[model samples]
Target: MNIIACIKQVPDTNEVRIDQKTGTLIREGVPSIINPDDKNALEEALRLKDKYEDAKVTVLTMGPPQAEVALKEALAMGADEAILLSDRAFAGADTWATSTTLAGAIKRLGNFDIIFCGRQAIDGDTAQVGPQIAERLDLPQITYVEDLEIDGNTAIAHRAVEDGHYIVKTEMPVVLTAIGELNEPRYPSIKGIYEAFREKEIKVWSLDDIIVDTSQIGLKGSPTQVKRSFTPATKSAGEMLEGSTQDKVRDLIVRLKERQII
Candidate 1:
């Protein structure tokens, strides 16, 4: 089985700050980490590889050169290979363009039986790329998958839904978006880390390496535009009412009425 796990290097939200004047993220000093959910996806892929003797897990990402760090981390977690899709033409791509680029890269990587991805990246939280990639590839996709198993060429996935979870079965050559509850990600071992940095060569691909239409990549291809972005105003502390129970209740009601929250 050839499994491809798509990952992303995202800003550590804990250290991210907004530029008040520019209404943009202050990324200059922020550290990047693998998208938390993507780690779960990678873990699932690694587990599948462990279970299937012939399985090969390849971790792929599209970002700046620094994203190589994310791919290396995957290798250290026991992925068989890593691929970096980097190019100036891929800059400022929205979900649509990003998925398009990824789909092209997957095509160039040859036949893949399964593609895994996180439900969403923490920074964007849009949860669109995985489904969009499936659309581009014209493959079946299962999102919010908390558990998955394979038999023969069929994939059985337990997908999370609002009410509960439901099982979905799809054939080979499918995309799955994993939720964090799927599995606990394994930490990199000493030997694995050493091999990642010293023995493995992460394959890098530029725009020219993959088949893509010039009009469907990067900022020029994105249809959605951010008109403005700003941090929400800090909320004020709530008032504390002091009185008899009945008196306090009455006062709260009056306040609610006054604020039109009744």
Candidate 2:
């Protein structure tokens, strides 16, 4: 079985800061880590690799040259191979264009039993890339997967919803977007890290290397335009009501009534 896991290198949110004047992320000094949910997806792939004797897990990502760090991390966690898609033409791609590029790369990979991705990327919470890739590939997709199992060529997954989860079954060559509840990612072992850096090679691909339409990639291919990026205004502090229980209750009622919220 061939399991492909898609991951992204995102800025550590806790350390992220916005430039007050520019209203843009201050990434100069921020550290990058694998997107939290994508880590869960990779973990699930690793677990499956452990379960099937013929299973081989391959980790893939599209980012700058530095993004190879995330793939190395995946190899350190037991992925058999890693692929990086990097090219200047791929810059400023929105979800649609991004999915188009990824779909092209997946096609180049030839054969695959399953493709796993995170439900959403922290940087862009659109949550559209996975499904878009599925659509482009004309493959079935199951999102918000909390649990999953495989039987021969069939995949059984628990798809999370607002009220509960729904059981879904699909054939091989399907896409799945994993949520955090799926599994906990394992830490990289010292020996694994050494091998990943020394023995494993991260194959890099450019736009020309993959099959894709010239007009459907990079900034020119993006349909949506970001007119501006800015931070929201800071919220004001809430008022504190001072009085006895009855008095406070009466005051709250009056406030609610004045605001037409009662």
Candidate 3:
């Protein structure tokens, strides 16, 4: 089985600045890390690889040149190979554009038995890319997966539901978007680190090499654009109550009513 884990390096800090003029994320000098949820997905892939010794685990990511750091991290965690899709034309891409680019990369990489993704990215919590890629690839997808079991040519997983969960099964080549609650991620050992450092990965790809249409990439092809983003101003502190419990409740209710919060 060939398992491909789609990973991303996102800004570690939440203090993202929005460029008001362009309505885009200001990524300059933002320290990035591997998406936390993707780590869980990678762990699941590694576990499957361990269980089935013949299985091959590969890590794939799309970002600027710096994103190779995330792929190396995945390598250190036991991925067999790594691919980085980086291109100037892919800049300012929204989820749709991203899914398109990733699908292209996957197609270029040939066949795969399974694909894994994080439940959501901290930077862009739209949670649409995984399902979108599945649609592009014409495969069944289980999102928000908290548990997965692989058996031969099929797989079963517990997908998150509104109030509970749904246990679903699909044939091989299914896409699974894993949540952090699925399993505990492992750290890279000395051997892993050494191997990763020595492994020469496939270099980044641009639109030219990939033969992607410039119009269908980057901000131009992105259907959804951030109209506005800003941090809300802080509000005043709450009032202090000095009375019995009942009195405090009454006062709180009155204050809530006065403030039109109820």
Candidate 4:
């Protein structure tokens, strides 16, 4: 079984700060980590690999050269191979363009039995890339998968919905978007880390290497335009009533009456 796990390096939200003047993220000094949910996807792929003797897990990502760090981490977590898609032409790509590029890369890789991806990336939170990639590749997809079971060529997935989960069964060569509840991601071993840094080679591919429409890449292919981005105003302080409980209740009633809220 050939498993492909898609991941993205995102800024650690806890340390991220917003530029008030520009209404944008201040990424200059922010440290990046693998998207949390993508780690779950990778963990699931690794578990499947553990089950199948011939399973090969390939970690793939589309980002700047720095994203190679994320691939290295995946390698340390037991992925058989890593591939990085980095090119100036892929810069400023929205979900559609990103999915298009990934789908093209997957086609070039060929012979994948399963493709796993996170439910969404923290920075974007659009939750569109995985489904879009599935569409572009013309493959069956199950999103928001919390649990999965594989039997021969058939895959049984538990998908979370509004009220409950649905059990979906499908064949091989399917795409699955994993949520955090799926599994606990394992940490990289010391030996694996050393191998990742010294022995494993992360193959880098450019836009020229993958087959995709030139016009439908980067900022040009992105259709969603942000009109504005700003932090919400801080809430005003609440009023304090001084006196007995009865007095406080009376004052509160009067205040509510004055505001026509009573």
RMSD of every prediction:
2.3, 2.4, 2.3, 2.6
lDDT by candidate, in order shown = 0.94, 0.93, 0.87, 0.95
Residue-level lDDT tens digits of model 4 in 40-113: 99999999999999999999999999999999999999999999999999998999899999999999999999
Candidate 1 per-residue C-alpha lDDT over 137-180 given as tens digits, one digit per residue, 9 for 90 to 100: 99999999998999999999999999889999999899999998
User: In candidate 2, which residue pairs get closer than 3 Å at backbone N, Cα or C atoms, i.e. clash?
Assistant: none
- Score candidate 2 by TM-score against the native: 0.90
Model 3 segments more than 4 A misplaced: 20-22, 200-202, 211-214, 239-247, 250-254, 257-262
**What does candidate 4 score on TM?**
0.91
Q: Is candidate 1 or 4 superior in lDDT? A: 4
Candidate 2, residue 53: the lDDT equals 94
Candidate that scores best on lDDT: 4
lDDT of 3 by residue, 1-262 (tens): 8999999999875657778777667888878889999999999999999999789998988898888888888899899999888877898898989988888888887689999999889987889989998998899999999999988888999998889999999998899999988999999988988889885565677775564556767889998856677656779997799899999999999999998999
Ranked by lDDT, the better of candidates 3 and 4 is: 4
Ranking by lDDT: 4, 1, 2, 3
lDDT value, residue 141 of candidate 1: 98
Off by over 4 Å in 2: 19-24, 237-262
Q: Tell me how candidate 3 scores on lDDT.
A: 0.87
What clash count goes with each model?
A: 0, 0, 0, 0
* Per-model TM against the reference: 0.91, 0.90, 0.89, 0.91
**Residue 37 Cα positional deviation in candidate 1, in Å, after optimal superposition:** 1.4
What would you estimate as the lDDT of candidate 4? 0.95
